[model samples]
Target: MGELFQEAILVSILAGMIRIATPILFAAIGELVTQRAGIWNMGVEGTMLMGAFTAYFIATATGSVWLAVLAAMIAGALVGLIIAFMTVTMRVDHFITGLGINLLVAGLTLYWFRMYIKGRAQPTFDGFDNVAIPGLSAIPFIGEILFDQRLLTYMAFAAVPAVWYLLYRTRWGLELRCLGENPKALDIKGLSVSARQYAAVLFGSVMTGLGGGFLMLGFSDRFLADITAGRGWLAIVALIAGNWMPRGVLAAVLVFALLESVATHVQVLGIDVPHQIFLALPYLASILLLMGLRRQSRQPQRLGIPYFR
Candidate 1:
């Protein structure tokens, strides 16, 4: 009985880790593409917040989770367009533009949420249900952890390899990657640098929006102000810690997710320490990871630099 209980707890923790990693994984992999195209979007947090808010509003209002998901993507695209306009078209400093975006979204979402719920009880909706893969989900321990998850969770994990292929294999991907290392090379080839950067930023924001929606739909029925917490910033940290590679980003996200999952299970494990310590584990780990890996960074040379014709 004791052994079975321990095994069950272990499986639960691992399953939780995968679920927790979903949102961050989605954002990190998408942002990896954005950064590789030379745009250092600092507004990921704000974009995510906006997406969450949009998803919440739509889900409650429309009674359709799918519509909410779509709305969130739209919200992200709008935010991405703003980032692109400032950083790519207006030639503003990327850092400044991203910071401005974060601030703007934070303020805007707060106001909108307040007005939305004024004089009314908070609304709620049903979140996504896990879909177990037929044969795969029936496997002993591995199936429960990997094969039984929300549809979006599978999509999020699959995105890592898809992104890897896009970044390393295809022609358009090669051009996109070139935008980070040498936009001038594309320019010399008579390619439109702004176009590719805009596409990259848009794609990242859309995925980020989807992640936000997933966080709301897959995890909670109702929305709260700043519901994304600092996951967006964590995603950024994961990217840097992973040296902007897809596999590395996934690993970093898993580390953070595992820490969070462990935190959630501390009480069940009969640990006596303060819960706050467990809650802080992922952020603390992120700081240490960044410090240790900074020296080994393989960041793109032209990243965050505005391109000029």
Candidate 2:
């Protein structure tokens, strides 16, 4: 009985990891897309907060969660466009611009929240349901572990295939690579460098925004002050650890999620583990992953260097 209990507990731990990974997976893949195009947009935390706030507000006002999701994506795209124009077209310093955008988004969300919510601590969400695949749900332990999740979680899972296809199989993908690698060369070949970068940045930001909304509507069922809690930074690190590939990022996200989920469970279940040490697990893993892998991956030579070409 003791042995079986430990086995069940281990299975539960794995399940919890997958559950926590849902949002990080989305954000990491989105940042992966951004970095692949030679841009590092670090404002993901703020964008996520906005997404969360927007999703909750729209859901509350209209009682339509779908609309809230749509709104969050649209809002994210608009913000992405703004960043693209500044960083991609204007040739501004990418790091400074990204940092500025993050601060702007964070302040704006908080300001609007106070103005609209009348200083309420948080806005609530009815959120989405945990959906299960028909035949897939019945396949022993692995089935429930893999198949049952919220719609956003499923969407995050499905996105891996789509992202891989878009980045690897498409002609547009080649152009994006060329733009990041040698924008001047692309310009000489008559390809529009800024146009491609703009698209990539905006697309990346939209994914990030959806990730934020996912936290609010899909996971937390509410919005609170500064609720992103540095998860955006984690997403950025996951992108690096994955070497900016969709498939790799999925694994990276799962690993980090497991660390966090383990920490949360140990803390909540009164497992007698040092709370501080466990709480630091995910972050420590990210740092180690970055240190270990960065030496192996060679980023685009022109990355974050404004592309006038």
Candidate 3:
């Protein structure tokens, strides 16, 4: 009986880990794309909040989850463009600019929510439904574990390979990488550095937007002020821990998710641990994970540095 209970406990935690990991996976992948272009966009947290709010409002207004997602992506893209215009096009410091964007988005989201949604926790709405993969979903423990996830979760996995191919296997990726490593080189080759940088930033923002929308339409059903809850920052760190590869990022997200799952399990089992400490586990673990590997990890050499012609 004891052994059977333990087995059941393990499986339940694994399931929860996958659930919590979905949003993290989405945000981390978005950050991965931005960093690969040599700029660290730290406004992801604010952008995510905006995405959540906007998706919620649209979903409430239209009664269409799909339209809410579309609006969220557009919102994120515009926010991304603002960052790009400030940093890439105008030659501002990427860090300072990103911070400003964060502040701006936070304030704006709140102000608008007050005027429109009247500062409610969120506009009430139903969220997306989970999906079970055919055939694969029935295959014992692993099958049930892996195949019975929601749509966004599957996309997060699919994004791994898709980003990998885009970043490492294509001509555009070649040029984008060149822009990151050596913008002058791309310019010398008659390519427009600012344009490529703009594209990278905006493109990265689309992912950020999707990550935020996933929270509304995919994971949870509502929004709160600063609803992203530092997951955006975690995603940035995840990009580093992932060694900046899509596959690596995915693995890192999974590991983080698993830690979060265990933390949740520890609480649920009524263990004699500080609830606050367990709550802090994911962030603390991320910091330790980064510190432990910082010496060995290699980041983009030109990261956060803007290039001038």
Highest lDDT model number: 1
lDDT of all predictions, in order shown? 0.91, 0.77, 0.79
| lDDT tens per residue, model 1, 1-309 | 243248888899899999999999989998999999999999898888888999999999998999999999999999999999999999899899988999999999889988999968999998899999999999999999999999999999999999999999999999999999999999999999999999999999999998999999999998877689899998998998888899999998999898888777876666776667867877788788778877887798899999988
List TM-scores for all candidates, in order.
0.95, 0.93, 0.92
- Summarize candidate 2's per-residue lDDT along 53-74 as a digit string, tens digits: 8887898888899898888888
Clashing pairs for predicted structure model 2, backbone only: none
Q: Enumerate clash totals for all models, in the order shown.
A: 0, 0, 0
lDDT of 3: 0.79
Clashing pairs for model 1 are none
Identify the candidate with maximal TM-score.
Answer: 1
- Can you write out model 3's per-residue Cα lDDT over 4-82, one digit (the tens) per residue? 2586687777777787777777778777777777877888887787788889889988889889988888898999989
**lDDT at residue 83 of model 2 (Cα atoms):** 77
- Sort by lDDT, best first: what order? 1, 3, 2
Ranking by TM-score: 1, 2, 3
Which runs in model 2 stand beyond 4 Å of their true positions? 1-8, 119-123
Stretch of 10 with least lDDT, candidate 2: 1-10
* Clashing residue pairs for model 3: none
